[model samples]
Target: MTKLLITLLSFCFIQCQGQTKKNETDEEKKTRQEAIIKEHVYDCADKIHYTTQMYEYQKCLDEGIKKDSTIAYLWQQKAMPYYKARKYSVGKPFLDKAVQYDEKRWLSYRAFMKCIFSKDYKGVIEDFETCIKKYGNSYEMDHTYSFYIGLSYLQLNEFEKAAKIFKQDIEEQSQRLGEGHFLDLFYYGISKYEQQKWEEAIVQFDKSLQQYPEFSDAEFYKAICLMRMGKKEEASLLLVKAKKDVEKGYTINEDNAIYETYPYKVRW
Candidate 1:
């Protein structure tokens, strides 16, 4: 309605200017204004739109899909926001259609999403390999393709492979983003801790703490590592402090996150 008012007002101005010259009738002016409105509507309908807000982005994509269901890219485009918003159930059908029409573009990503939603760590390792082979180490999100593959390996108890990937990721992200980046330290530490590399895990946790002193999960894990190394008193102190972080609502991340239990199992 706001758009209509603006366009209508502009049309009225233009029509009034040439009223004497063009001698247009009321019906003729109405018809021309209607054509202008129709053109604006069509332009809006065909536009490739984007929005940062997830719900708004969903609405925009819905309108686009309604206008032309045959457009494969629109299906792919629509799936992304839903997945990012953690609405995988809503996103799944769109992903299916996206790959159905545009296999080359959507296949690897679609497979990755399915693996994640299914919590199939082994399948994540397989699909992430496919994703990297097709698209390389693309960092379209918080965790890179390598990160997901490494975490999958960890889930499968492939500690050696997990450590190798986790170490390399830690180093690379550190070089690019700098040392003590929380995720790099957390994952690397967890991989080491799983391997019973107690001292090494403590070092990673300490590094993480240097960056974020109140990091609850890191403190919790560090205390566990210390306890294993026979530092009971220090470990007890850290446990007390770590509990405070939880009291303040800091949570441990399940699976690949260092915040969870030492072995890091998948949580749905």
Candidate 2:
């Protein structure tokens, strides 16, 4: 009876192995077919559509999905053309599906940025956290994810938490960029500004100016801090410099004038 039971278990294991092999074969075939469908879709869009509208892209995707719904990369690729064309609303749904099918880290980043563009800060925060979990921590990681997370929280009016996170991000950036990175100073200044730490913001703006003397935004913020601190004369001079530099096209960026309480023709 024991020998019979052992024989029965061996047969079941062999059957399961056979079924696994068959599943693997089918999966491989599906992958190959999806590749063919993606190539055809690209070709079809190129031949048939002069404008890569979302509907046209969706048609191509439908064709690919009909061939192999499991092809997540095909969905991702379909979204790419629309994203490149700046049809974000059209691409966003497909990108969401692509994540559902395959949650790759880079794709998560793409989705996070898409959500940011879409003004879905909550979704952006979630995706950014997922990215950090999958990709681990690093300089770009801290600057990109943590900074954005703090921004999202600030936008959502979680100021205390946002301030703490932003400070942590600035600290991480200082460690990574040796406290002298211009962008690091920008972020630090912005973080302090968000927290209403005008004095600290001024110090950070100064650091930024020391690194890049013509840093327009830093100068603008310094003027703002001066205005907040009731030093109108100094603020006015800085604002004048900002306006002159801007009018001369020495600083074409609109942020300097707009943020400095100076009138500008262009608003960003």
List clash counts for every candidate, in order.
0, 0
Top candidate on TM-score is: 2
Can you tell me which runs of candidate 1 are displaced by over 4 Å? 1-67, 70-93, 100-116, 252-268
Q: Write the per-residue lDDT of candidate 1 for residues 19-127, one digit (tens) a residue.
A: 7436878687556544443433344423534335555555555666654454566677677656655677777788879878766667666656654553557766776
Provide the TM-score for each candidate, comma-separated. 0.62, 0.66
Clashing pairs in 2: none
C-alpha-based local distance difference test score of model 2: 0.65
How large an RMSD does model 2 have?
9.2
Candidate 2 residues lying further than 4 Å off, grouped into runs, are 1-53, 80-90, 138-143, 179-184, 210-213, 244-268
* Residue 105 displacement in candidate 2 (angstroms): 2.8
lDDT by residue for model 2 over 1-268, one digit each (tens)? 9999999999999999768646777677776765666465656654555253657756766777876676677677676666656578887877777777777634555644443445567876787787778775432333457766766676676767766776676677677666645554665676677678899888877887787777666677788889999999999999878666655664423232222322112232
Report the lDDT of model 2 for residue 262: 22
Give residue 95's error in model 1 in angstroms. Answer: 1.8
